[model samples]
Target: MAGSAQPSRAQLGSDQSASFRPYVAADQSPAEFTAKAVVIGALFGLLFGASTVYLGLRAGLTVSASIPIAVLAISVLKRLGGSTILENNIVQTIGSAGESVAGGVVFTVPALIFLTPYGPEYFRYFQILMLAAAGGLLGVLMMVPLRRALIVKEHGVLPYPEGAACADVLIAGERGGGLAATVFRGLAVGALWKSLSWILQLFRTAVGYSMARTSFFPNATVDLDISPEYMGVGYVIGPRIAGVMVAGGVLSWMVFLPLLTILGSHMSDPLPPVPASGLRIDQMSAQQIWSAYIRYIGAGAVLAAGIITLVRTLPTI
Candidate 1:
């Protein structure tokens, strides 16, 4: 193994660094963090933030706004007399920050509003604003330490697909190639598809079919949302994570729901904490059963998973 011609540490590092080059060199300083960039980014942030909140409230999930923001920023800045790659990146970062904050607030704050004895009225605008600000500050503070390690040093070692995609968009815009045109075409197609479903009402946005009740299986159902957004997300996350998500859905719908239905159907009275409606489990639909019981189980499972993950990562932290 001695005469195999292994590269020295310095040579290896140089090779690795040379493999990936930034659109703008490190030594170059550009018109980044400019007043126009900040203003444009803030405007986009507010726009996406509002939309994210609405989407989260409706669907309990939010789409990543980074790519769209980057695309828009590039187009806008080009029309406004051109901008640097770093300026566009700064715009994207600031705009996506709003979506991130909105996502976090919508997911957790609603639960607090519902669960607290003081009720939704207790959470005023100022209180919610403060909560969001604190969460965003904490997140930024935590990432400050890890940014160099995970984002900079690791680089290709960690498959940060979203970040990579965003960077590609910025670079493509800067280079003025077919890649940027393709992105705009995709945007147009997505917009048309959404309009067809939402505005024209040509078809259902979601569809579902409930399986017939049998001796073995009961209250089983399958549902799918026909949305470009979800498809894009699944593609971005890749098949393995998507498969795991599908498996969880199957466990909830096919396994747990049927078992619960079979066991509870024989009972004459309504379940506890559900009020005395005199409706037995057998009378309830799959959706009703899920709302009444299975959601709590799912929530518990998520809590357990989070705790386990935190415990595993605590040493590293």
Candidate 2:
């Protein structure tokens, strides 16, 4: 760390005309598209796609497989005795399609059956294949226009985190080795912590308590979760957005619970949903009110906010 030859963060992305620049240079000819590259890329794509399905089902999330796939491509190709940086780039580009398509279909296609009257039978093999195919095609077609503006023009300025990180991985791989190890280190630490928490049962992943038990404030819920991934995400997004999200949770548990109790306890008759014979608001638990009513409202509010943001950004896009 003391006498490192590596360029510091401050020096990156400053030179527009240099070979390090993202765009094509006059002196450099493009890498030939090779058959071997295509075959290898397809295999990695299939592998990542299958793994993504399992991950999405288990964790309800999937990471960008490009960096890891690139690292794997580099390692695998070098051993086969026919490899180049360009081939690695090609492999990553093609393989990345798998995870991207998987995310879109896994999240939406299955939900369509439930959202509609169509049963499981409606979502047959052909239907699923078509859905994924169309979605992938549409994504590619949309990106054709966006690539020049968003990717090239705004290369370093845009701050698209995933794209930037992938670039870093590829560049590091080309330079030598250490950068790829960082990805593995992260994977190891995450697996270790999760194993300690769940396997050993050392501590609850999330510890929560109602403020009514100890504090002057009634019905307030506090939760502390030892989730590095979530906390790191919060920091990356910055304070304002994270604070707004935390405030929403506080409002739901603290303000809404108490307010509902005050308003509903004194009701002359039970609300429409709550039968006359059933328990009143004062009788119901805070969790019941949240589950039955508040959650719907919260969902609608979020949907509205997303729509507003999209509308506001439409002109820029």
Candidate 3:
């Protein structure tokens, strides 16, 4: 006690807060959850919700709407008079909710409907609506507790990249100067590039090259999707995570596909779960082999990874 120094009040408070700073102070109340905000958010929700469902059904993947919602909310709210930071956040939250619900429903509900004996005819619109509502409610309930534990308690540990990025956009928009202009400029450039590539057909959106079939490696092909949106996502997620994603793709395309081709080259008969075309493994192209066999493998791997992650986090939950 003689030599030891006691912590100051500021230091104690800082330690308790875990270095997390709020955009709006606790003492201040802002114009959040207004009628206008709700209306705008709902309109955006409907727009994004429909688009996400379409994308998910077509591509079996959905993009997060949080950042886009935030950007749009700030821009729209600013144009229609001015808005508080909290109002923009409220709009973003409401709008992104639709995207989240659509993403979940499209990913699993269609599969359930088609996979059953009755097929899609068995499920009515009301049933689908109820299922989506229940799923959304369940997710919210689950996140209630987890949010406190993961987000509040372990603030610094779990770097929620999407949430952080959205927050940055909101803050920058609130400041309304160079930062806001920078964000809009990037969005404009991306829009122009996408329009040129996709709408005008100025250039190829994706490029692919098929390697010559050799004795050792057959049907080897490499492809790249040089979309502006995807490139923007890679930049946001950082190189390390992007590299891991690229590595997975390379492993699947280069390593797994080649090995499968080599092993199945001698097989005269078609593989089990044969494609609609009913082509033998040896006769099938690289894309056909991927669609028939590799897709299932990838799905199984993803399922296993999800289970493993859930098991590991059970204690924390």
Candidate 4:
């Protein structure tokens, strides 16, 4: 029964201890927490951080780099030899910090540049760096107290989805295959689609039609992007959540945009931001109006939602 599974008390509790066991044990230590792991992890972290910032600025979303960093660290440490799984874990821990910091800063910092009239010059390097450092330290401090309550006590009661997937990847590689092929297939499909749409420009990356000519629904439009990345995200988050998100988009496009166009059309005066020299709102396309005004409204809504969520969760914290 040595090769058989054992239940984990930390996760499954004493009742299920006979059924599951932790991948890592309490006492069996390996060459972990090393300088080389820290250095290599930092490099991976930096790469992910920069890439995450760019992706977030472009897409208004960011993803955790933990799974990918763990995978890469595992592969590298294995090839280099004389490294333990513990060292690999340490490497990923240090490396993923870059992505975490970048993710936080990019949310606020880039908007100060691109969303403002003054542009990138207004964004100071030292100020942004300090902001990121402060945010990162704050997150670490906050999590330190919760490690036992959430990570240990709750255990399998809650799934750390990204971390679990990364562990699966590591184990799969070591055991010489599992459902990892499915993951590779997904990667191949996504890569191929991106190459066609982005690199080759074989087709429009985003395809949409506007109903501007129709008198019944002026400024009402639908837009869809053939983005593999976004599609994958939607698929992962699942249909219900994706549908809710689509509802928000529908509100912005069908209800809000049309209403704004109608209201603006009746007015003879140019709106301050709309510019006195510019054509009236009737003349402006939905895309133009969205760029000039609607984006701020969307950002405000998101901020409000975040604040409300924080307020609701304060008691639990």
Candidate 5:
């Protein structure tokens, strides 16, 4: 039994050593690395940044689908015989910038318009851009300390599904596969859809509807239909998470909205009007309270989920 355990331990050690082997290692001067970084960064930055803007405009949803796209881009590049570590890292960093910015801008910058002297309508020009760039810098800084904890030490523990996908794309690129074309096609379709939607006013940002003001074409609501942005989201999220998102949407739209309207109608006599839009607790209802305050329960659940993941990964680190 002792002899058998020795072989098992030795095999485990060998497997880890093999897994740690670097693929597409680049031995180069600092200057060369810098140059490569700049070139790769610029390329991926444009690729992902453009993608973010397009998706944002199309769906009015700030999506982080760029991570997978970056990975796919790197994979295609690798398959084309240029699978370099420096290049791929540069791509990851650059591509990640757009997502980082989009996340921050979507969450924070919109609040600025409302909080500032001008309402969100005033930020139609460059608020999003400014916030996005600033968010990019913040993301870079935030992820720096995480490098050791996430990339180097954790290894396979955290999954880093995005990173792994990018690595695979890079590898595939080295082999001259069709991923490059597929990615480019996705980008083109996404961009065209966004541009056309904006021009055609497919959705309206009017005060009453919360941005889903498209005409009910052929007896169907536009929001319920899949668009380029939704397709991109589905691609990056895969099937399970996509299902979760769709479920959430259905719950919010079909269940919550209906329930709120019914409750509001029934309680209309007792309480004052809910008002067009203001932060008055007196005019709100149990449903409104649940939607506004109790929704934090869901936020806490999400936060707890993230914390639990981090905690589980701590042992691996």
Candidate 6:
């Protein structure tokens, strides 16, 4: 009789309330919040897109400075009391999504510029856009299932320093000007480092510092090294994940670099002498090489790690 009894008014309301509560780290209606997110995201995306394009063109390389820019923008906005901390984060997250999309687009878009010399097709802008969108969607979808396991459950497992720092900024802002000195210090330090580094390089023209051969270190192979980029990556990833990355770096540099150098010398019609401005091993032919190789390997490693993580977290979830 109890099992068959209808629910009371309070019980019904409780169920409705639970159903209506917002999810995804924000407390707002999906349609309304998402609309606001889209507008805010678009503005940030335009800024990031413009900055990236300008910097990339000027530097002759792709430089992803969007994350810091977004963080700085949010921090500045908080000082003005124009938006809440959560709102700023939401806007930043939404806007920063464009960089991910642009990354995928740029990879293939360059083919139009360089590959056209050998082929008929030129500038697959539409194809690149579609691929970029698909990749962006996939990344979002993949990260969705991991958010709870990574962000919610594993509190200290993933340090996520950037997120923590953003939170700290917001909390400090609430207390009024507590973070002003820290912000000023960060900017001053960054500017000083850049200025000093440039000044030191005034007379010396160091050419081989790219993903090619290094002139300073003879026979050195260049890949992504341990730099500020990697350190920031390590900080957000926590020590566990950072260790894995270091392992990857060791594998690529310590093992892979030496092997490539040896094998490259023995092969029939071996690579030409190292270029003055290069830092990577001269092993693969242009036709034999593709960016997808590195991408696929990275995807596989991340997939395997994520799957292992999710399996371990299933019971708790």
| TM-score of every prediction relative to native | 0.77, 0.65, 0.76, 0.77, 0.61, 0.47
User: Candidate 2: which pairs clash?
Assistant: none
| Candidate number that wins on lDDT, 1 or 6 | 1
Superior candidate under TM-score, 5 versus 6: 5
Total colliding residue pairs, candidate 1:
0
lDDT-better candidate, 2 vs 4: 4
The best-first sequence of candidates by lDDT reads 1, 3, 4, 2, 5, 6
Which parts of model 4 are misplaced by more than 4 Å? 1-23, 111-121, 152-161, 164-189, 272-280
**What stretches of model 3 exceed 4 Å from their correct place?**
1-29, 47-63, 106-131, 144-179, 213-215
Off by over 4 Å in 1: 1-27, 54-63, 111-126, 145-161, 211-216, 268-283, 308-317
Candidate 3 structure lDDT: 0.79
lDDT digits (tens) for residues 1-317 of candidate 6: 76798976445545554455322346543222445545766777776766555433432234443445445545656555455545656666766677656655654455445434543364466766677778888999989898765655455444677666656654444455534455457657645654655565433323332233333322333344322323344554578966765677556545544445555555664333433233333455321222313323444565687789999968645
Candidate 6 lDDT score at position 296: 38
On residues 1-317, what C-alpha lDDT tens digit does candidate 4 reach at each position? 77988765454642343454777787787677788888899888888888788767766777677776777776677667746667767777777788988988888776566567775776688878888889999989988999866666655655678877877766665554333345457779988998987899888877776777346778788988868767766766688977877888898888888887887888786655764238677677788777667777777887898899999967544
lDDT of 4: 0.74
Which ten residues in a row are the worst by lDDT in model 4?
11-20
What is candidate 2's lDDT per residue for 77-174, written digit by digit as tens? 66677466677788888888977888777766655654445557699989888988999899999999998766555445557877667667666666
Clashing pairs in 6: 212-278, 212-279, 212-280, 213-278, 213-279, 213-280
lDDT, candidate 3, 1-317, per-residue tens: 79899876445544656766698998999899899899999988888899789766644556788887888888888888989999999898888998899888887777566345475786788888998899889988998988776667656555678899999989988998434455578869988998999899999978997665574556767898887657766776678977876777787778878887887777888878777688887777889888778866766666787799999988655
**What local lDDT does model 1 show for residue 261?**
90
Instruction: Give me the displacement of residue 74 in model 2, in angstroms.
Output: 4.7
Report the Cα RMSD per candidate: 4.3, 8.4, 4.7, 6.4, 7.4, 9.8
